[model samples]
Target chain A: MSQYELAVILGMTAVTFLIRYSFFALGDKVQFPPLVKRALRYVPVAVLTAIVVPMVLLPDGRQWQLDWRNAWLLGALVSAFIAWRFNHLLAAMGGGMAVFFLWRWLLA
Target chain B: MTTTYHPTRHGELLQGARDSLPMLAGAAPFGIIFGTLAGPSGLSLLGAMGMSLFVFAGSSQFIALTLLSGGAGLAVIVFTTFVVNLRHALYSATLLPHVAALGQRWRIPLAFWLTDETFAVVQHRYGAADASPLKHWYHLGSSLAMYGNWIVWTLVGVLLGRSFEGLDKLGLEFAMVATFTGIVVSLLKTRPMVAAAIAAGAVALLARDMPYKLGLLLAALAGVVVGVLLEGRNATEEGQA
Candidate 1:
């Protein structure tokens, strides 16, 4: 690997470790205020949703592409419905993949 | 508090590993896909496997591979991966109360081994009201199992590369979309949570072009702020009434 590649890996490892270690590193020495704690609670759902929304809405990760060819969007909706009903991660994955391929084939 | 933990270290370790089977199932496909894509992902074999060994976050790894293949700048790749993983801080915070006394030896490795799958399984173990003190072993069990699973599958993907030419084109990534669907649906338990999700999603799309994914960073902050502010207002209104 080149110097730049090594730099990317090292930089990522440092930042990732810091975020993961923040609370443990702090331990009893520091305490989060109540409001910050409340906000922290919402981080998971909000962040995960944000990450996927663009993936679903924009196939190229560049712009909004809403059309029949966008099987990802349809599959995403189907996956959401499955998740709500079944509440199984693997099952939702399977169900969504099944629908995605089916939509792709049908559209083709 | 209902279930008793295993008496021995080995027993708890096995139990943690066993209990994580369902979650392991969820992470396996993604791991394999990453390995298969790694070469085409333009990374040296060392780079591909090394990332799984070190960075260890599935989503961020995939994002990094994508940007690297596209020749995105190193700073952009690093910053984007970092933003994607910001959620881990919340995961660490949730588990801190249970793990506070474990000290660095245990806590650091646990943090390193922690992944979305391990968190899902171990969080339940930690959240349970059981009087058992072996929750850390259980945490180790799940995290280590996830760690091992990632390494083994990446190797498998590397070995299976090229022969599976159509794998990436298969649109199998929809499985992740499906998995996130389940996660978001389950977690949207309140009004503020839903509001946060919407704000984050809207802002992410609007800010996609922002350099270094600053839009995503801002979106995450916006979501948290909106949720917390709404929660505070709701509590105040109820208090006055």
Candidate 2:
């Protein structure tokens, strides 16, 4: 591997590992305040939504594609609805991807 | 569903792997796509596999490849990786109470293998109303499954990319969105949780232009604050009623 590539991989590895391991390393040494614990309860929902919303709404990461041509938004909506209704992971993904590919083909 | 039933560690481990099946399905395409694109994005074979093995976080690895392709500097790539993965810190903290009693050896590997899929499944397993002491084994099973799945698929994608063309543009990454949507939807058991999701989505849209993906962090904070405040209000109303 090139020097630059190695550096990039190593840097990413260190940073990602540290972030993931930080709290586990501290363990019971640091007790979170009750308020912090309450906040932590919402982290998964909040973070996942934050990541998913923009990806669906702005697939290009630069512009808002809210129209029908945006297969991502449509597929994600279908996925979310299926998940809410059936609460099945495989169903959500399968239904969503099917819609996404079918929508793209229709558009094309 | 008997109250007296206790699952052995081996059973828990296998159960964890079984529970991760859907997530593995969701992540398979993503890992393969990453493997296919890594080469075109200027990563050597060793570098790409090294990343899948060492970095092990799909989103950050994809982001790093994007930044590298864009000629971003080393520091920029690293900083963005750190910012994007800050969510894992929250995950680790959330699971810490369950794992705090384990030794460093267990904690270290568990932390290393803690991906989005594992966290989604393992956390639910931990939250289940069971007194099984083998829950950690469940976590281990889920982690190893995801880890092995990622490495193997990445290698497959690398080889497949060498033979095929245009696999990266197929929108397979949407699998991740679909999977995450399922996870978040299931987690929305309470009104506050639903409100937090809506709040986070709105704020993330508004703050999409923030540098270094800080918008994600800001959106998550906003959601957490809204959820906590709403929960507190609900508690107070209950007391008054």
Candidate 3:
């Protein structure tokens, strides 16, 4: 590994570990305000949705590919529906990947 | 409502591992895909494994790889990593109450091993009303399972990527989206949660061009604000009614 790559890895590791360990390290010495605690409840849904939306709507990461030909969008929709109905992670991923590959082939 | 069954620490640990099986499955493709891409993206084998071993956060690692491949500087890549993994802070905060009583030795490793998958399963375990004093063992179990699973799959992918071709182009990364979708759907039991998802999605769409992937952070903040406001409004309406 180049020195630059090593530095990047070390920097990323430090930052990530600190973020994960911050609260646990503080333990009972610090407590979030009530509103902050309430807001924490929505973080998972919000952050995951934020990440998923751009990935699905703009698979290319640059353009907006909102159409029938966009297999990612279609597959993600199907995946979301499956997850909502079955609440099963494996089923959702399996079903979604199936749809994604199938739709891509059909379009190709 | 008292039950006669009491699980031992070892039992809780094993149960935690068992419960994380689905998440292990979900994360497998992602880990393998990262390994396959790491080599082609100019990372040495040790560097790639070091990332999986140390960074341990899937999405941030992916983002870091992307930024690196794009010729981004170390500072930019590191800043992006911070932004992408900032959500983990919220996770640790959410889980802090349950783990606060533990010693630093336990907290340190547990915190290090925490990921989205482990958080989902371990948090659920913590939320359960069982009277198990050894729930931290359950957390340890899930953590070790995910950590080991990630390393193994990354090794598999790294080896496979060397001999095989075009594994990254197979669109297997979509598995992550599907898994995250499942998690979000399951977490959407409340109206605020549903609103949070919608608000986050909309803002992400609108803010897609933000530099250093700051859009994700902005979108999440917007969603949280919208959710909190809606929850407050609902509480007021219910009070008046």
C-alpha local distance difference test of each model: 0.76, 0.86, 0.83
Residue range A29-100, candidate 2, lDDT tens digits: 888899998998898889889989999998988888989899999998898899889877668777988998
User: Per-residue lDDT for B1-241 in model 2, tens only?
Assistant: 0123339888888888877776776678777888888889999889989999999999898888899898999999999899889878889998998999899999999999988778877776777677788899999989999999999989988888856456556776687787788778878899999999999999999999987678988998999999999999999999999
lDDT of 1 by residue, B1-241 (tens): 1144676777778888876664565566677888888888787777777888888888788888889889989788878877878767777887777788888899899988877666655665665556678878988988889889888888888778866555556665565566666667767778988899899899888887876456767787788889988888889999999
Give each prediction's DockQ, rounded to 2 decimals: 0.48, 0.61, 0.56
Greater-lDDT candidate between 1 and 3: 3
Superior candidate under DockQ, 1 versus 2: 2
lDDT, residue A27, candidate 2: 76
Q: What does each candidate score in C-alpha RMSD? A: 4.6, 3.4, 4.0
Error of 3 at B226 (Å): 0.5
Kindly give the stretch of ten consecutive residues in candidate 1 chain B with the minimal lDDT sum: B1-10
The most accurate candidate by TM-score is 2
Candidate order by decreasing lDDT: 2, 3, 1
How many backbone clashes does every candidate have? Answer: 2, 0, 0
Tell me the TM-score that candidate 3 gets on chain A alone: 0.81
Order the candidates by DockQ, highest first: 2, 3, 1
Best by DockQ: 2
